[model samples]
Target: MADTFAAIATPLGEGGVGIVRVSGPGSLNIMKVVFKECPDKVEPRHVYYGHALDASGNVIDEMICIYMRAPHTFTGEDVVEFQAHGSNVSLRLIVMSAISAGARIADPGEFTKLAFLNGKLDLSQAEAVIDLIKARSEKPLSIASDQLNGSLGQEIVAIRNNIKDVLAQMAVNIDFPDEDIEQVSCDEFITELKRQNDRLQSLIKSSEFGKIAREGIKIALVGRTNVGKSSLLNGLLGENRAIVTDIPGTTRDTIEESSSIGGYPIVVVDTAGIRDTDDVIEQIGIERSKNEIEEADLVVMVADGSTELAAEDFEIAEHVANKKVMLVINKEDLGMTAAQSDIDKLKSIIGCDTGDIVYTSVKTVKGIGKVRDAIERNLARGFIKSDGGNIVTNERHKDALVRAKAALVHGIELLEMREPLEVAEIEVHDSFQILGEIIGETASEEILDTVFSKFCLGK
Candidate 1:
């Protein structure tokens, strides 16, 4: 028998309502003992208004409660939920009342862990539940929801089914070599293996986009002080997130905010200007700026179009030469006073031959739209378009595919060499079992513990 567990499902704070959840074989019994107003034969799936009592019969709260019976609840066990006032004290007391009635405080993710153990959700789907809760944008939420609904799992299962069919053919050849059956030709084996290999490789390649969708792209804005970096950030963010002033190194540290480019999540980081400075703090900030550029997925090299490119400008350009870079010549409103030769020189140094170079006047928000377009074109060239595709967002799933792909490739090589069917079947079966780990069909205890450990209490 599974031990009963109870927890506060909702966030702890003052709100209109909070939920206390209980799950296990003893869930209904605990409810019957604590909910004094419900009849002795309380019906499942029915709502009841009552005052909950502790084991000693002390009233804990007056609230609405619902009971869901075994095999249909979230944990596939008996469950009880209480909708009470969102009082820290009251909700804790309610949980305590349930504990007093024989339930224990649920560990982090224990509820969802039970769901996984009870066959309610596979390992990937159970993992998606946490991803769904943590998603901050539309695309990530959609991807997580799809995974929860078994999109990725279904794909893996389908691939496994194809491999099983191939294994069956190989099995017939092994079981009865002289039984007058059509043998699996090497050509047929090679063709089917190649097809399944293509599908597996495509799914693995989607992990890059999946990671971007989950963590968002990081874009760093780098330039000298007073070159309108702050102004540009303010304009793009549509607010004054960073201070704009004539003082050099005003932004002593990195200022970051989340935004979207072409509906894909992005983190725009405005770093301190990259320049030679004697002030210790400004030097520190400049060093941090260099680190940000190194880590950024995209670096925007802002330059003053009103002045000639200086040694510092060229030096900054060199720093971002290797990264996916854009050159934004700010202060175009100053009449493009800087010679075109110098502007072209800056781009040449930064290697922005085919990259975006949009002039902007941040004071008037001129060319801001072009900047956004340039960002989309530069950073999100191959970004997923949220077209309801099965984007593999988990590293574990990707690893399984990678190993499975290797196995399939090996199996194909063996078949191509005209090896015995029994020899190739071993690799094919390995591939099948590896994929089974993704959907929890053959997952071990350690993997399950590691996954559920990331979840919050009560799911």
Candidate 2:
């Protein structure tokens, strides 16, 4: 049976050029039969200019072909790349021609899947390829790139190796009790297990911050009607994405936009101002704003600095007490009627301690940077250290770390109870397996399939 597959690598659209990538055992053979070049035989890793021909010996198109032999190719198999005319119809015809000459269409992620199966890449490294491709922010890209380069994979392997070594020592101790096999004492086992457990727990703690970094934080702008929520959003975005008007309830729905703050991606939401209203559209908007406020990771309560805090302000304060609030006292350009004393009184009434409120004039673009800094501080709480360092970014790694940590704790408990070396051995074995899964040392076919399925075709 033919072990070759082909697909158009580029996205289907008008482009400068298009490419058809083929891989497998028959790649070079099929290229020779269908391509009129190189004396009817193609050498591996050589790019050749050629004319693609059909079964009737008629020229279909002029193209460029490159052959990559097994062991050095992406899929660890023979590979060919065809640069043909930039047309969907032409590319499809080329693929069909290769199929007729004995190649099958590659399934989604099949090329990378083959690479994983062939030992070219581990499960985590394979996953990093997709993450790198889909990364929307610089931080995510950096994290994914590090993972692809095997930083995360290396760490996992190291942890798994440590656990496996401990298990092997325990196995020797259990089988050859008389032999001086450097048997691990109960106290030593407990101490070592706790050490690894703490390390694993630290990694697991980073998962939340990693998620926020991957998926931007959601910030909801909420306040009483006519409080300049839209103005603040536009000021932060540096564009008039949200409509601004003097009339209350002008913004009848939520407006969403993305921006980078302190190297973190943040999705800012301009929600309709909350207030009592009878208008049908206004009521609907008010409801959405409530939901947005409830779901927000950060809430910016925009209050009019020109007036004293009202009942509505207190209501907002009560609603946002549970959320991370950055009290924005906007319209400082309006000649502040509320002085520091008034702001302090408002803070007291809102039940917020000092330092949560920010004085700003959106019209003049003041204090916007501080707001951004505050949002980043909240989002980056537990993930990064003071000097800025690497943190765990994969959910699988985080889960494995958690499981390993738990197993280590169990091992520690067994050691404290002075149980048989075999008892501690079982818990140590469990921890070893958990760490192994992280590095693919003990991962099953189902896990591998699920991880690689996230990749795009021709990866």
Scored by CA lDDT, what does every candidate get?
A: 0.87, 0.78
Clash count per candidate: 0, 0
Model 1: runs farther than 4 Å from truth?
A: 235-239, 333-335, 353-355, 363-370, 385-388
For residues 1-459, write the lDDT of model 1, one tens digit per residue. Answer: 789999999998999999999998898888888787878787889999988786678887788889999998889999999888889898988888899889999999999888888989888999999889988777788889999998988988898999999999988988988998989777897899899999898888899898888889898999988898888788778898999888877999989998877766889999999888789998998999989999998899898888876788888988899988899988888877778888888888877755588887767755777788888887556466444558988998899999999999999999889898788889989999999999999888998888888988878
What TM-score, to 2 decimals, does candidate 2 have? 0.89
Clashing pairs in 2: none
Per-residue CA lDDT of model 2 for 1-459, tens digit only, reads 437998888788777678889999998877876687745555777778888876566677889989898889888999888888888877878887888888888888888888877888877788888878877777878788888888777877766667776777777777998986667765765666676677677677767767877777789998888888888898789999987889988999989899877666778999988878889998999888888988888888888888776678778777777777777888776767756775666566555545667777777655677666655665566233333434676788788888888888888788788888788788788888878777677898888878877766666
Q: TM-scores of the models, in the given order?
A: 0.92, 0.89
Count clashing residue pairs in model 1: 0
